[model samples]
Target chain A: MEQSMKPDGMEPRTSSLLDWFTSTIGRILISLFVPFVTFIVLWQGFLFLRDSEAPKLVIALVAIVWGVGGVAILYVVSNWLIEQLPSQWVRRLQPFVFVGPAVAILAWYLAIPTIRTFWISLFNADSSQFVGIQNYLDIFTKRFMIEAFRNNLLWMVIGTSFSVSLGLLIAVLADRSKFESIGKSLIFLPMAISFVGAGIIWNFIYEVRQAGDPQIGLLNAIWVGLGGQPQAWTALLQPWNNLFLILIMVWLQTGYGMVLFSAAIKGIPGELLEAARVDGANEIQIFFKIMIPYIMGTIITVSTTMVIFTLKIFDVVLVMTGGQFGTEVIATQFYRQYFSNRNFGLGSAIAVVLLIAVIPVMVYNLRQFSKQETF
Target chain B: MDKKIGSAKRQSRIRDFIVNGALLLICLIWTIPTLGLLVSSFRSRDDIATSGWWTIFPHREWVMTEKIVPPPADQQDRDQPMTFAGVTGTFEELREGVEQDGKRVVWIGNKRLGTVEVQEYKWITNANFTLENYENVLSGKRYQIVQGDGSVKEEQGDDLSGAFLNSLTVTIPATVIPILIAAFAAYGFAWMKFPGRKILFTLVVALLVVPLQIALVPILRDYVKLDLNGTFLAIWLAHTGFGLPLATYLLYNYISSLPRDILESAFIDGASHFTIFHSLILPLSVPALASFAIFQFLWVWNDYLVALIFVGSKPNVQVLTMRLADMVGSRGADWHLLTAGAFVSMILPLTVFFSLQRYFVRGMMAGSVKG
Candidate 1:
């Protein structure tokens, strides 16, 4: 009691309720709430419009216009109005108004879907009624979904590994080289092409030509010319085809890795490199001993990023094999379940599975950005 | 000073060689696929069907082929040396096929004449070459040859003349609307004293985590209810929705890094928020705005998912991506034509990237590192 009283009638100077509400904690609430409220009203509005004489298509188009338009107006007005206040007050509350519309939209679009998807996972494919964990259980029990899950593991382990390693190697090799810019640009060029486009490009390279049909596809024609019967590379089934798909991701993601890691590699002090040379270390030794440690943070950053990206990869599998022929990744699988199969629960469950798989890496990545690694 | 500079310059030349050589190699690799795509796009389906681009050099040569109609086999290989007049014999021919094996003819004039027959007859001019594939693709016959799948063959736009305009309609406004709004917001956030600025920024950043798929259904429901489901307007709104988070995030990062003093002085000098935004913020943020513009423009341009949901896949309304996908999904197998069609779709994106790419200022990364 005496100790408490001596502290000027305050309780150990914990954050004030007002301050708590105004700061980090309260703002996150805005992140969560604004999107929710916006969505509920939009859904309700859509329902209300259901009875109107308006055509369903036109009604939806208008609501979409309004939702999007409202977000734009809110973004401009709130930000401008907030800027008028004093700095200290603005600093405390500015983030809310500035980001509120965006967060609301994100929620309206992403957050609500996320929550509904989670709920949908508990329901049947049509999302009409509840089904509980049966959909999730089906992931393990069903043959096709299981194979898809297995393929996703392959994507996560192999695709991420190759992308990270290749990217890192390219980043290191390209850095400070005479052709660094050219090498990097070349490596980066694949990224400029869409995954869909890349699929089309590679399709030609991997194209098969039947005996009479002059092989339009370079790959199959080359194969046939080399004395092997032409084979559809994408239809090669598992093991090999999986590697084929992974190659595409590596081709695309290597550029991303190189950009991030190259910057990190540059961040290493020139002094350390000089010291390694003075110590009679060979170039290889210096790279492994001195250089690797210096860029380890960057490497971690890059690898974790690749891991997250690998987890979310949908387009590659979708375009390449349509997630069939043993190339199904988790994200593609989610789309397959939800839309193609019309099974919302399974799709949501798949989404959840991916989200769960990525959380650890996401946390780890965010941590690396903030927490300095010890030498 | 001159001597030191000269020595350094000479040393740098050696380094330049290595750099330039490497860059050249990189550029070659980058360009090769694009080159492949472009060349592939123009190639005849028959040419594509038979050989690789590497063969183009040899394939381009005119192979003079001399030939005569042989008697029906029922009439028997006309016995005895049927003269140039009776045998309807044809002379030797040059060709691009691998069967020629450097010089050996796979299908020479009648066997009765043998090697000597080469001198016997005249060549049919320009008989082997064709632009039929190009015509077919442009004329839309490419669907049968390039896309094997009857159900899924991508319909080449009735020159897609209308869809092209529709795509532009969806893309430009989608891009413009977001950039305009984001510019204003960015200036306000950077210069004005707003309540909850930090928190608002943090929330916006957090929005990055919310995946788009989650909102697809609900958004559709909302759109349908609002009677906006099947128009360019819906696509515009959808593009803006998806584009805003990234646009604001990027613009905010750029604007916040502007010299605070310049903005402050303007504020004190009786400049309204609008005035400061118009005069100073807008002028200086060219790089940021350009980069975001590139992003928004390219995204709205290439986006498939939003267009698919809002506009539906009706032939008249479909975009290039959908059409191309139809070509692939249906053809079970027509890669050559697919490559060509893909190139057409890629042209706009590539041009956009190249022309506006200068705006992707490296200094933005400088801010990311520091801030």
Candidate 2:
């Protein structure tokens, strides 16, 4: 083994693989870097293509040159810089290549749009006049808007937990079963239906009929057949209607949760399961004691996804009842204020509130994702 | 020992059957409503009103009351002695001969026409049952139904040409535009490198939190400024913008996951990033691109809000969901018509989904979940 080393007494094979990632490929990129950057780098590249009324040829040229240069140059620069630095820096440096595009998009779209939204929230309806913090104050003061806040909280708690728990339960039960494929597909079918499509379908189910007349809505129809009065399902003025709306979210999201949970379950090591079985543990014990703890990170991930989804609940409410009858959620309230009322101040305040509610969940998810990517 | 092992095998077999059976039942329960809706969408609204979707299988009775009017002698059918309910008469006596081919005659219930002679067999399904609704719809009889407090107002809804054109306007570009933007971005994100990459990724991932509703007001305001509001362009842009994050994210995962060795070798072969992207990346990403295209296409097809806001309530600018909304509201009580409208709207999405859904699943989590 010692004789296999170079005359310089260094590991020649290790050096070459390092050399492949660095110099040979690195030189082409470094040489191409100038031409690439000069050609590709431009102002607001995506938006420019969008705004250009120019012919397709011009747009194509512009986009290609800019993109090619940026990618090739960045690769060369990042690789060359990493080679120059100590080995300790390489691990930390690799994430940039993966994450760079997402950051630029966020800066242009989200960061700018969000800050602008906040600024507009401070202004009047058309975004012309300044009205500092007044919109925020109005949300706290207004009754319907306050109800919207409460309803959002309810959606967040009930929707996220239900989607996660039921999904987990079903996933655990369905794992390795003969019907697993069918069971998951049936549930997952809802995931494909857009919020608007699902709402339209549900409309028939929740459709109400006159007491003596035949029931048309599947749900109310069933209720009537079972001898109950055909109640206006969404017209219930109490907490019941909110739960009914929440059920739509649960129905739509349970499939998403199930998919995630099934993946998590599949990820559990077979040896651990075998070890638990060998200990004479029953099926329930093996699952709860061994499997659940092992996939806890995945459980957190699925729930966090639910949290983000619930925080932005909109379409079901908009389509079903226009968020009327006390089913007003944050997103619906935002739409109604901004679009319907054209009350920019109030709308921005609601958006700000929603943004605030979502940040912690996002931070937690990012941390978890980065944690996984590293370890 | 042999007996115990055999007994254990028998017990496990029993457990398997019980477990499998329970799972099938659970799947059935979850799927029943969608199945019911699909069935109901195909059913006549009256049938939906009258019975459960499950009732479609059995013998069922429908109470139908229709009026009859005798046709001019020139309009009379030459086939046979048209008698209804054992009452034989001419144009002077019998009150039914269905209106066909611009000739007016009343429809007798097929069951009633068969047993109860209306003096002629002129009125029945197909020739009369249809084209009348289309005629009525074309003539703006859509606004004819005014039930309770008149909560829904009809705004000169789609006459055939109008609705058909409106639907085309909304769907075509809404589908085409997003794929264009998403493909480019997905390629760039997947293959290109830049600064602040992961954080930007985190941001886009975080954007999954930004609901479409959150941006509606602001985006609409921008569109209004650009004078693009109420144009097909606005709706197209809205759908494209909203659909891109996921499209790019999904495509990035897939494109990035392509064997780096392949891309590096292509680079060595003097393949420009564009050539590599257009040829190798695009071809391989067909599955991912197909799935996202299906998703965005279906999403744009089914989207109601972006259509409503960007396209406005103009009758000619409406998409299917908006038109369906209008149709459902105007013909609110006529579920048969509503079901028809729903099925019409659902047709494209379902066709697109069944054809491309495998891709939606694969493209969605391709890089995220390592097999």
Candidate 3:
């Protein structure tokens, strides 16, 4: 036993078969038994709770206790099981107890599903027959797909640029202003609102009424007040309606950009800006040269996030316009194809296209992350 | 020298004015949309439909028609006070209620002898604000239609309250599970020595950008196969899976940056990783944990698509966002209910944001900029 513990500097020591239960490999294998049973028990409990006709309040209470307590018990029991093994095996098996569930979940949820989606994209509708490249061909040549691509591009360009730039502008202006916190809070307020809520909120702003009716919608009221025809901003406008939809995202996301840029701006050493100013840099010059370049990392990070977000924009479009009037983005297209048309193949293909479009940004982000090596 | 100093001070003053003005304008633009909804939620149905929410001020006169059945002659005194609906007033006051208090009050009802008419009385009044929208929305009673027999039937509303509870049921476990799981994984990535650590960690990082849409179809199929669709468990697991990557990424950054000496010293004291994590690392990571908790809480609480796909708009299980989305789709003309419902869904996230804003902002900064 003593020799087994001294593997730190000693060669491998043989043990009896009975003693094998306490050996490193033996304990590692034994550690799996407890968690496996616990998982089965919890799964059964979850299934029971799901199918049970109990009162909702009772179910909810039981679930909260069971779900949360179940995870806690799982960890404690598994850790206890590992600790009962020889000290040498404890070290070998502990990491699994820590990282195993997360890795398993991520693989099941994201990594594996992504590959599955690609495979499904290669098949026909209902996934019965293989139709390689046919779905992709439709995505490229179909009118709706083309509209979605164009709108997504517009969202990527206009939405990202507006959110980031407006955020940067506000961050700069409110850097040390007395109203800095207030302004930032107001802008960031929308970020807390669900996209569905924001869609409705903006719907009030974009609502159109009959020509003689009182314009309850603020935008229409303003338009009619200015002697223009009361227009259906989200339905009638061709390309501009897309901008109207994009505005909700910009409104929701600008605060995100602002908060990040503000933090990054504050990170700029005061002495650097003071030095630049002392050397006779004007405000615009200081902004362009020192401020922009100083927070350029943050700018890129925010821009990349905004770009990715805009690419996947769905809820606002789904709620506000239902992808009508030239507001069809890739995500809404995927929704229509998969859920509405029941064309899983085309939906999967459209989703894959979206994923492909985002790959460059993801790769660039990875490079930036690795370069910083913040971890 | 005096002139130079004076001009510099004036230029600085002008700059301050411009900055303040610009920020004020921007904040106004940002807040007006939400403010419009907030105001509209308090106005009566006719007011919301006929006039803008902005007209709530200036004490707009509303034509409120109430069908009043005159009280029996025995119950018309000040003690009993004639009452219709919820309004109570003496017979004399109710008959000729021309003006009371500062608001102009006018009651139009035909009085025969000492009794008020049983017909409808339209009150031209200045009391514009009403809590009926919130009441109706929260209570799930859309309208009360008077039948030909004079019986009132209360139609069911969107049941936002039930959905609100369901949202809580989904959000709490979803938020808590991911944080706990991610925290452990983060500790492993931060401190543990293991094979494939680098590759596994990079895999998690790459997953941060995987659009959740890609997982929907397969997962939906799997849920159908497993008979997990429309269950709280289904949506909870879906959210956990969707939220794990960022949770791990954020927690890893925070846990990895913890002072190495503390963990090293704990290890030297014969503390196992589990013990050290529970006793020391967990306490030290509160700020990180809090930020990520808020992040996950808000994300899961405000989620629509995941809940919609997994939970399936079954009224009993639908979350607030789904119910609100459904209302917007079906009740396009019911801005009164829509505005109130939208506010109901927003209440929790807004409260979390306003109160825990520091941690929330820190989380966002770490989530985006630190990456």
Candidate 4:
């Protein structure tokens, strides 16, 4: 079996220690040991350089060296070691060699921390005392948390629907128009801006001042210009401020949805639309019957993606209103609880609840992914 | 029949007009907010405060009261101090007198209670715009405070340039590191057969949606233990960890779809998996890599939550997003600075987005469509 697995070019040499060291089992063990050691040594060097009173430039240089160059070298050396192994051992171990570092990092960074978050959710603010289910109860019962849940529900439903519908509307309308690409690009431009940036832009639009003070915010400026009293838009509007906040997300994400749906719409065969038209279907009927059905998969895809986005909506809330005046959502609530309030247990619970809310969409997404791969 | 055909053509043209008009209106509405901000950033602070950005275009005469002092009390006009409103002075006279004390103060009535500069000049000026806001915000000029004694003192504020650099520092490595790691894992998931591959791949796909919020406190606790909190390295690792699942998933989709024959031929030629990946797969996956690079770049550039949690708002390490948010918190009323600062932070991502828009759209589809 060993002989069969050997490559064609070279005969196995077991005469010397160096030859033994180059053998399959020896190389596998070395491959396992060397990369780990190299990573540790380099990582330690980096930390040491960072901690020392070294010059900023020197530390930055070392960081680049360790982060990019060192990581690449580690991988290369490990791969070289794997190549020294016989074909059978190489096939068996090469996958591990390729995948092991990523898995290790993921385990360290994600899996472990996630497990730890769950564990910490059972404890109090500083994780000093174990108070199982108490934090979860508080999250479920507290007025703020309840408001957060309600607000999140509002955001998810309204924000998702508006973005998807607008996106679909624009996608359908803009198709085959003379100004199609230009219109789509204009709508899609917001996707480039960060949600935080979008919030700042929208905040200017929603800004309000004293009645006598010039109305700087566009909404108020228009309101005051039209003979109506200018009110603080985000502040005065009760439950609707959440809708206003959702508007920013809608603005930002509609572009995203439009782009995706536009691609999907363009993918629809012209023959189908022509057939529907010839059958005496009007534009609206063809849209509902043929176009909508044709892109229903895309609609679901876009909506679910936006739903996931709306579920984790944080930056916009943080920037626009700081979750004040009845605009608190789960992500901001979690932030305030953890960072401002310093309630670790409750924060973790909020996070867990968010995790719970997102899991179904994620599961659906994964199913879609696997289904796509199968084809 | 000819008349009916003509009428139908006209009707359809009208319908087309309405459809196009609605789309055009929606497009304008979508873009106007950003346009307002951009215009606001360039306008004078007073202009931003007093009028809407939309008011800039129309040519209108604005009667602005410019304070100017009378040429140091000439004996003839000593009793006639500069009036607050409608000061009797030419533009050149006001400009000349204001150049002396450099203090443009207001004059009340004919009594010279103090040396005050008051001048009223009328001019039909278009939109008053200045780059001062950008300069002030970028240079970290704090809001000045007028003390009880009428002395101005500068408060300490965040340096936008510093924060911008820190964001770049945090972002570039965070973006690159994940792509490298994920590419390898993606290659494994794509081509190499291993035990538990299916389960591990599924786990990665599942982890794609695991809220980074869930990982925050626990990882932060660990960072505290490891003394990694608030470090650039810490944020990089955190970002890499959070970004890995999606990166791996996207790259796996792209890599797995590559022609199997190329890889098989490489295998038959006795090329090691490493060599094939290095020479063939990595180069061939450039498009996929470029797409993910843009995704990760934009994600890291725009990320607020992960950066906030792992890298606290320390001056030296605070990113642009965190710093921009801080500015909003501290200087909420300073819309000029906020607008300018927001644009400054947005410039890089906007450039990336516009330049690589095609790839960005592709990345978005690859990220969402299959998922």
TM-scores, chain A, per candidate = 0.72, 0.70, 0.86, 0.86
User: Candidate 2 chain A, which ten residues in sequence have the lowest lDDT sum?
Assistant: A1-10
Q: Write the per-residue lDDT of candidate 3 for residues B248-329, one digit (tens) a residue.
A: 9888888888887777677666667787888998899999989988888888888877887888856678889988888888
Docking class of 3: acceptable
Instruction: Report model 2's TM-score to 2 decimal places.
Output: 0.70
Q: Which has the better lDDT: candidate 2, or candidate 4? A: 4
Instruction: Provide the overall lDDT of each model, using Cα atoms, as 2-decimal numbers.
Output: 0.62, 0.63, 0.82, 0.79
Top-scoring candidate (DockQ)? 4
Q: By DockQ thresholds, what CAPRI class is model 4? A: acceptable
- By lDDT, is 1 or 4 better? 4
lDDT (Cα, tens digit) per residue for candidate 1, span B111-210: 5443221222223222234444444444433343334444444454234334445566566668777776666656545555445654554544544444
**Interface RMSD values for the candidates, listed in order?**
9.2, 8.7, 4.2, 3.7
Q: Write the per-residue lDDT of candidate 4 for residues A1-375, one digit (tens) a residue.
A: 000121333335567886675675665777788877887888787666557666544555566556776668878887777666566777788888888888888888777877778888999998899999999999889999899889989998999999999999999889857899889888988877887788788888889888877788889878887998987778766888788888988888798889888999889999988888788899889889988998998888788878878888999988888888998999999999899989888889888888888778777767876786442
lDDT of 3 at B342: 96
Per-chain TM-score of chain A in candidate 4 equals 0.86
Per-residue lDDT tens digits for candidate 4, residues B26-50, read: 9989889988889899987667767
The deviation in Å at residue A110 for candidate 1 is 2.3
- Specify the poorest-scoring 10-residue window by lDDT in model 4 chain B: B97-106
Residue A303, model 1, lDDT: 66
lDDT of 3 by residue, A1-375 (tens): 000111121224566775654675666666777778888989888887867888777777777777777877888998889676666687788789999999998998889989999999999989999999999999999998889889989999999999999999999889958999988999999989999999999998888899978899999999998999999888875887888888999999999989888988899999999998999999999999998998898898788888888888888999998887788889889989999899999999988887887788668757866786544
